[model samples]
Target: MNKLNVLFLTLSSMENINERGIYTDLVRELASRGIYIHVVFPRERRLGLPTELEIIDNIKLLKVKTGNITETRFIEKGISTLTIENQYLKAVKKYFGNINFDLIIYSTPPITFERVIQYLKKKHQSKTYLILKDIFPQNAVDIDILKNNSFIWKYFRNKEKHLYEVSDMIGCMTKGNVQYILNHNPYIDRNKVEVFPNSIEPIDRNNISIINNEIKEKFQIPAHLTLFIYGGNLGKPQGIDFLIRVAENFYKIENSYLLIVGSGTEYETIKNYIDSRHPKNVNLIKSLPKKEYDQLLRSADVGLIFLDKRFTIPNFPSRLTSYFEYSLPVLAATDKHTDLKNILIESNSGFWCESGDLDSFIHLAKSLADNNVLRKQMGLKGRDYLEDNYDIRKTANIIMKHL
Candidate 1:
């Protein structure tokens, strides 16, 4: 018997495996089982950090310097995504060329890792796994960022197809994701696709009540009101305009408060609305550190999720797990295409409505705020659901079985 060696390539900048995130949680679980985890992540140009490798939490981390990929202009993001494959390949060769990996796992957003995967699979004879988190240029097209079937779209579409073709297994975030990939790319074998969801090592925050009030006081979160929070990325994908509408109409719901936390392209749009309008029931913050954000989650009564109604792909935001971890019920307003509504209904955890329906959101928001018993019941169910389905141990088992 031999200890497993896995190489994980991701676009997410994780400085430590102990950090709170889906990717970090999964790798931490693997490392706990005595597996050697090698993580290669990007060091964006904006950070001013050079390419370097360091041992963090018994995991090998290779930070490859690359162009600005996030929170930057469209041109820079495009160029960075285009060139990342070569940069990653060179980094992996220079650093871990001699080590033979048992498995190579990679995630999507760029969909330009075909060359690296092909090379690694051929060289190491290792199984390749594709964590299909983002559905590439199509998601861009859904949001009106990229024109459908344009030269740029076609190029990336081809890249996406090839990336799938090279992978030995495709792990999707949900069943909808699996079906979408199969339907869109008939060339792909359905047997290789499985539901590998956005999972995390859920913290037991249900019993921890020490800092709840202190954190509330620190953030000026009203203790008397039933707090509803919208955290994580606030970009176009989240339907920021719809969020603004929700904030504007939040006055209808009494004895409640809405807290919007995060930073993105639409941050200014939402900020301006909150600043100029000065909704007494709403509070907007740029962002918070993960530790503080987790504490803030404890003080919240409900979690808010919003998605653009135009998306054809089933986009599941990872923020749902954070709410579940803190035993907060979820209230989602998303496109009909996603299975989030079904999940919430089946789990008996929360409520959902179409993104554009302000009245429905208001009604649901009021109901959650007005009833304390209902909120606690739904929050418990959400925590149970997280333990049953979205735990990191389940993800580790699935990946290990495949390997």
Candidate 2:
């Protein structure tokens, strides 16, 4: 039998297939099973790079040049998103047009990829899978970035529905996400949508030797304190205002420290707060390289997740996988709508509180800080849960079934 060929469409910028991430891990797993994967991703203007293609371990990487899609002004971001489909289509035609793809998979952020998916499905007679990572226009509306049911909202909503229509299968991050989509968009076939949570290649931290003291000293992280880390995006959807409030009152947790990493539009908000208040227990890092961030993750005691309280859509942040990889307990404070709380309770992996509740967050933080035994137990459970449920093999198998 001929080796199956697959095309993956994504906005996530990945330069290599061996990078330790959800997408990279999944692609590597599929490639190991003798699938030829073709990935089409962005080369944003900020990088000053032309569209390029590279082949690694039987997998093809097509980097298409597009406008600034991340961490830019609203107007540029909007225009970039609107034009991405055409840019991607042109690049795909010029390069991979001759290849008869067996399956095509795409993820969401900009729902404007309808035309691209529609064209590919017809051209190659390929099966299409939609990885519903972000529920866009509604999520924007929840954060007050876009007005509900406005002209812009209607335009994107139509595009979103069309994207769903073209997809042969839809995979959501969690069960709550699955339900939310079915409830809002009743037109979608329920059987087509299923729980395909964000997953990763789980690493056993036991085998990795982490020089804790060196990492701590290098980053000026307090050696004695119970370190709590909030990594990933520092954006509006993360509920920056509430995160700042948590940092302001973080001193209430005895012998505990908070470290905020990653960059986004709301980065300066936290930066300004830290500069003005100079909170002793809270340290803010604008960003860190992937290697340095993983080093920091290994040294940290607890992982933190925060989502805006206003979201009606269930938003599952992928940072949970990073925390679980290092056996770090998760402490998430999100809106009541997300099923993160249920996952924490079921896995016995960590604790959760409603996003805006300061007392609950501090209480949970202090308990985890004071009790090393409890933290260790939860951390082990988290690692176990991650290996069993969110493994890359499971995700790859799901996509393979479609083929």
What TM value does model 2 have?
A: 0.98
**Which tens-of-lDDT digit does each residue in 91-209 have in candidate 2?**
99999988999999899987888999999889989999999999989999998889988999999989999999999999999999999999999999999999888999887666544
Candidate 1: misplaced stretches above 4 Å?
205-211
Query: On residues 183-275, what C-alpha lDDT tens digit does candidate 1 reach at each position?
Result: 999999989999998999987654655445888887787799889999988888999889999998898999888999998888888989888
Ten consecutive residues with minimal summed lDDT in candidate 2?
204-213
lDDT minimum window of 10 residues, candidate 1: 203-212
* Candidate-wise lDDT, in order: 0.90, 0.91
Extract clashing residue pairs from model 2.
none
> Residue 273 CA error for candidate 1 (Å)?
1.6
